[model samples]
Target: MERIAIIGCGGSGKSTIAKQLGLTLDLPVTHLDAVYYDENWKPLPQEEFAAQQEKLVAGERWLIEGNYASTLPIRLAAADTVIFLDLPAATCLWGILQRRWRYRGGQHHKDGVFDRITWNFVRYIIGYRKQMRPKVTALTAQHAPHARLLTFTSRRQANAFLSEVTTSA
Candidate 1:
């Protein structure tokens, strides 16, 4: 996998998997959150964000992680592989809580600011499968038909795939 795009809900471990894949495959990893959000958690202008993504994807190899579905087509067009973390809402909620605890009072490497587990964020995670999954599914099918698509319904499967890739590599 020279070029990979990892997409999922807010707490779905996209960044974690991307980092692991980057290390295993010796590919550069790009966290779209870092690209899109300023140090203060302010978002870049839409045009600027798109421009940045355009430049990143122009590179020969990269593992870009984010769920910016609107801009997914850009990365999808460039990637040779796509991974979708289709974990349950409970798992994702647990992940967010765990992350908040782990990174409390400090900024996460992939996040723009210190972790904050708000009710709105929780609600978004809870509703993601019903609301966003279909959209992502259609977009991937439409934009990256030739790309290798791998969907993991649980963290165990994701980790197994990572282990398999690492061993094979």
Candidate 2:
């Protein structure tokens, strides 16, 4: 599908899925982290961030990944597909650890992704399903009711979905 939106808690593999979907669909991928944060980890101004997303979503084909709930409607309104990585908190925490080790606790400038970890982030991940899922679900319904929604509760399901996509592509 074109104009895809990927959302999830930190370390839930939004970026990973976005990359795979981009490759399979031959769509350009935009990591919202790249758009929202700078090399120094400074965030872009809120208005500018929203504007950037507006422009990105206006494109004919794109795969944007992030969970900026406040700005979610922009992408949601435009996406033809939305993929939610609804993995358990434990899995997500483990993902953070693995990514941290892989990056050696630093930033990847090319991807504009930071691999830093903190207690707050852990807490957020732990609380995401309870706290954020409803909001995300509501937003998708409100803004992209026509879009195909795909929610994977486990990595296996996600992998199988990817395999199917790859085969079709």
How many pairs of residues collide in model 2? 0
Tens digit of per-residue lDDT, candidate 1, span 1-169: 9999999988789878888899999999989888877667788998899899999999999999998888999999898999999999999988887877778744565543346667888898999999999999999999999999999999999999999999999
Predicted structure 2, TM vs. truth: 0.97
- The residue-by-residue lDDT of candidate 2 on 53-149, one tens digit each, is 9999989999999999999999999999999899999999988998887788867756536787989989999999999999999999999998999
After the best TM-score superposition of candidate 1, give how far the Cα of residue 12 lies from its true spot, in angstroms: 1.2
Q: Considering summed lDDT, which 10 consecutive residues are worst modelled in model 1?
A: 105-114
Error of 1 at 17 (Å): 0.8
Q: How displaced is residue 158 in candidate 2, in Å?
A: 0.4
